[model samples]
Target: MFWLLFTLFMVACFSAGATGGLFPPGAWYRGLNKPVWTPPDWVFPVTWITLYICMSVAGARVALAEGNGIAMAFWSIQIALNALWTPVFFGLQKIRLGLAVIGALWVAVLLGMIALWEVDTLAGMLFAPYLLWVTIAAALNASVWKLNPEQAA
Candidate 1:
């Protein structure tokens, strides 16, 4: 049972990370005016992959622990929200909605982190990078929205 849950969670995390690339490729993001601190495009995949691995392991740890249903549910909710972000921002080109989704995602991540902390501190800490990344993404999304208010669909 633990292995099954772990595998499922890992698959889900990988799928969520892949959603970021759903956008039409090549310069699709480059043309947009980004914040000065936006890291190079290559940095994103590396960061996201690392974060996803951490999230998967954290989730698996929680699943293997005792009485972690609530934490698991919270993690699932946040991940679902995380998955929606790429589609909203890239697939549908809804920057404002994407910002809103990511904002909610941040809160969900915080809740998941807290829940994980109660069960296992390391699990919670594993989620930290994901939380930080999402927070930064939220800020960037807001900046994009502000800079391209007219561009929002």
Candidate 2:
């Protein structure tokens, strides 16, 4: 049962991850002015792959736990926001909107982390790296928006 739940959660995470394939950051993103701290292109896929695994494991852990309603809700919210971001930012080329989406995602992840903690300690711990990654992603989004105000407009 736990393995089945884990697979389901992994499907959800990868489904959300599919957005990246659909809306890749091509020349437009390459041309944009990014901050010095921007992560190298190679880092994204590696980080996301690792994060998705962790997210799936955490979701699976909390799925059958008692009092997991809030955790599950937050999990759903975070995944939806996660899927929305790439389309908005890369597909639509709406940097400002992407910032908004990522900002909301950040909040959802933070809440999800806290809520997951309430249900299972290891589940909550799993989200810690995800939260950190999102924080970096949010900062990257904001920096991109700020650095290219003209493009964002």
Whole-model lDDT per candidate: 0.86, 0.96
Q: Which candidate leads in TM-score?
A: 2
> Candidate 1 clashing pairs?
none
18-129: candidate 1 lDDT, tens digit per residue: 7866664346556777889887778888998788788888998898899898899999999899888888888888889988999999999999999998998999999998
* Model 2 per-residue lDDT tens digits across residues 111-151: 99999999999999999999999999999999999999999
Superposed on all Cα atoms, the candidates' RMSDs to the truth, in angstroms, are 1.7, 0.6
Q: In model 2, which runs have C-alpha deviations exceeding 4 angstroms? A: none
State the lDDT at 86 in candidate 1.
88
